[model samples]
Target: MPAPTDYLLTHGGHRVEVTYKNVKNLRLRVLLGGRVVVSVPLGVPEHELRRFLDENHAWILRAQQRMRMAAPPQEQLVDGGRVQLWGAWRELVVADGDRASAREVDGRIIVTGADEEARARGIDALYRRELMARIPALREVWEERVGRRAAGLRLRRMTSRWGSCNTRTAMITLNTALAKRDPAALEYVLVHELVHLHERGHGPRFVAWMDALIPDWRARRLAMRGTP
Candidate 1:
């Protein structure tokens, strides 16, 4: 058996440490601070751990990059910068006019108001509008895939969880972060929440039903979780 510290790594922003124990599986996990650490059975060779990390190098880097980018300065909102809606780029334009509202015009989103401060408010308003525009399509897709009806769908600026469902009320609340992923992933999440109307928890039945509907849902779920 290799020494317990043989797999230690502090490269880049990720610090990984390894421990040997009596375990059935060689498990690798990224902690909340973006540190990836692994534990393996005592007899496993160090080469095996190295091979596993190398195989998953892409995922590790992608996770770290996402953690780094998620803390962007909110005050930097400006014109011509790309804001993602369903993982597609939407360019921003600031306009000074009588209309104190933001709108998506001519393939670009236009934020207009009498005061310069309205630009920031207008940008937030436009994000809400885009989300509203997507609700009907989301409901339709969910109905087809999950074979259930959602009484209502709401959007929120949630810090955790991409979406949630209230089976009692047949309502789903989706995190505004959905706007940051691809359209397909958004739809997948919508269907997922809608499915909760029929199945409450992510038990075996739910997994089977989800797999039945979206064959590549696991990949889409990983993509939304910021795994490249």
Candidate 2:
């Protein structure tokens, strides 16, 4: 099969990247930040591609709108900037110090370092430490409730997901960004992934299991995302 060709298509004031692949059907995806992508069979002519895009114009617009709405707001890591901590917005205070460190003082996040990069690193290290300290207890609680033990827990920064579980390996990976959200939200995610050890997909049975494990799981999800 030949490599996929990428080209730009603009219609009705919206631009989409069309990739022609060796496939039978056309696929459309609206990525985060409202980026549009379309995949179609290699032999699809430009006119047919245009017509297909026109037919799905409304869907493309709606998907882009939804993506924009679901996107998380960008955070500025600077002195006096507001950062989310445990579901509350707190002021960030950057200070110069011989050693870099981040801590909460007087209801504000204080990151002391020699430079901006150091301060940012210090804040990230602080979040990682917080997650390390908190995850064990949360995991233990949920493991006991679910009657399943996870192989291990790993933490990393993620933009698109809160957590993921490997049912086969019984390992749960959590988003380090959760340190910025409410601790309750972290617990919710832990419970969610732990439940995956028993049920793999988000179907009716999985939903029922979630309800039984965490009676208010839906509210926790909404609160975590700050959405309706």
Highest TM-score scorer: 2
> Which clashing pairs does model 1 show?
86-181
Off by over 4 Å in 1: 1-75, 97-100, 113-120, 226-228
TM-score of each: 0.58, 0.62
Q: Quote the RMSD, in angstroms, for model 1.
A: 16.7
lDDT of 2 at 76: 55
In terms of TM-score, how similar is model 1 to the real structure? 0.58
The residue-level lDDT of candidate 2 at 52 comes to: 85
Local distance difference test scores for all models: 0.72, 0.81
Residues 155-197 of candidate 2: C-alpha lDDT, one tens digit per residue: 8777789999998999898888898887988998998898888
Using lDDT as the measure, which candidate wins? 2
What is the Cα-based lDDT of residue 209 in candidate 2? 86
